[model samples]
Target: MLAIVLSAPVVLSDLYARRVPNAWLAATLLTAVAATLLQRLLGATPVVWPSLPGLVTGLVTMLPFYAIRWMGAGDVKFLATLGFLLGVRALLPIWIIGCLMTGVHAVCMLLFRLPRIAYAPGVSTVRQHLHASPLWQRSLHARQGRVGLPHAAYLGIAAIVTVLTPDLMHWEGA
Candidate 1:
């Protein structure tokens, strides 16, 4: 619940700017820590400080994807922050859900633009078709491929949803 509520702004920001501001992330972290301290002082169950393994897990998991340019640096940092706030166990499930969501979005976009799809079973046939198209059409095709994925928005949403789902991954608490 805390994770979900706190990350709401992040989701909105990512959706808007395709970027996660460092200041907001840091402030959220600080606020979470302060809230946990207050909870402890009140003799409530203290929010578990996310473990070292969780932090490392987040970094190790996203680093390769970032290296390949599949996702931006903001997404990597967002995942790492999520790991710190949630736990190591939540990272992969959230990531998987986010990826599946992105895949679904891509499929829907493709379906919506069905006319743009050109199916070719063979590589030679693909080249032949490409060459057959006018230069203007080819340029138009290239430009259409530049849609931004805005992975951080997807990922932040996934993380929030994952936390909201009851007993997801059998988590006792974060």
Candidate 2:
């Protein structure tokens, strides 16, 4: 359930923001539920497919990030679903990689003149600016800039590592 917990924020953010594709979330959730039930009925060693609910949840959660221009909708769903399928144990590395990717993207945004605010230490000034600006105005003023790498690609790599090295989650004895 680690994956589910970790991915919850991303999926919920997406869903709250309405940035995710409904069909995709629905399909993933359905698949996961079915797979989990099957695994229990058949007495499988581990059930992986039911983890898709986490993925769906992640996708839905990512809508906020997407709306805020923090991440793409696809990235949110992909990582969340990946976490669910892999489980909490498999999510450690994925989170590490995702964080790294997010950092890199942030740095690139800073370098590339994306719609970001200049750093100001004064809380009063920041508050004043926020109050003066319209809700969507801030997003509008922020330029649509490019972050070289796609987050999904990084997530894919993380998923591969987690799947191949399941021991990372320390489930060896369990």
Candidate 3:
């Protein structure tokens, strides 16, 4: 359930502007709340609430890119939501995997010279430029032509890794 919510934004964003839709975010948040409640009803012990930390970490890490116009607001929001849904224990591995996936995607894009597209700094900036720009614009104004790997895909991959290796987050100090 969490995985589904987390992955939806990535998939949707990839098809569009690598931006997570508001509907998706709303749905994910609702689902996460319900799931958490359900888990509690089922007698699952809560370790630590991870969503807040995950959101903070994601925002901090992605801020630079957002500032430089490298990523969209939706992407940042999606990552933070993913962190909240996954919680701290599971989120670490997911973050690791997501980063790895992003790196791989970046390398591939660089090699392929794929055009990258992103929203300019302000809403007004984007609005001002939209009329004058091509339908598909790169997010960054780089010499190699804008091309970037969809982070959502990597985020999904990371979620899968964490789900499969749930024990990885458990620490038993010997």
Candidate 4:
């Protein structure tokens, strides 16, 4: 519930602004630590260690993709934050399911846009296909084109769903 609540703004920001606010990410990290300590103090049953290793693993897992421009740095940081909150066991499943969801989201986007894009001329390459069409140009002042998946939003959704669904990812309180 905490993870989901924290991620809502992230998902909204990514959807509208194409960027996740750093403040939100920082808040998430602090909240994860504070939540863990509070849960412990409250004697929450089935408490799991907030795994720093899991956070590192999550960052490392996404670094190459960020380096290759397949994923954003913000998305990587977001996943690491989620890993810290979720612990290693839940983080693994969340990452896997998020990846799958991102793929599905990409395919659906492509399929939905295919008809609108098919008639555009000189769009022969993969890069051109992924970018804005000559037929429908954006203003110069508009933000730069987006490539690949908005994986942060997808990951946020995945994390929320994983945390909410029984037998998906085990939450400490669950």
Q: By lDDT, highest first, what's the ranking? A: 1, 4, 3, 2
Q: Which stretches in model 4 have alpha-carbon errors above 4 Å?
A: 37-49, 112-148, 170-174
The candidate with the higher TM-score, 1 or 4, is 4
Pairs of residues clashing in candidate 1:
none
Model 1 scores a C-alpha lDDT of 0.74
lDDT of candidate model 4 versus the reference:
0.74
Q: Model 2, residue 16: displacement in angstroms? A: 28
Say which prediction, candidate 1 or candidate 2, comes out ahead on lDDT.
1
Query: Which candidate do you rate higher for TM-score, 2 or 3?
Result: 3
Per-residue alpha-carbon lDDT of model 4 for 42-66, expressed as tens digits?
A: 9886345467987898899889998
Candidate 3 deviant stretches above 4 angstroms: 12-17, 35-50, 113-147, 171-174
- Tens-place lDDT per residue, model 1, 80-113, is 8888888888887788888998898778667645
| Model 3 residue 126 CA deviation in Å | 33
Colliding pairs, model 4: none
TM-score of each: 0.69, 0.47, 0.61, 0.71
Indicate the TM-score of model 1. 0.69
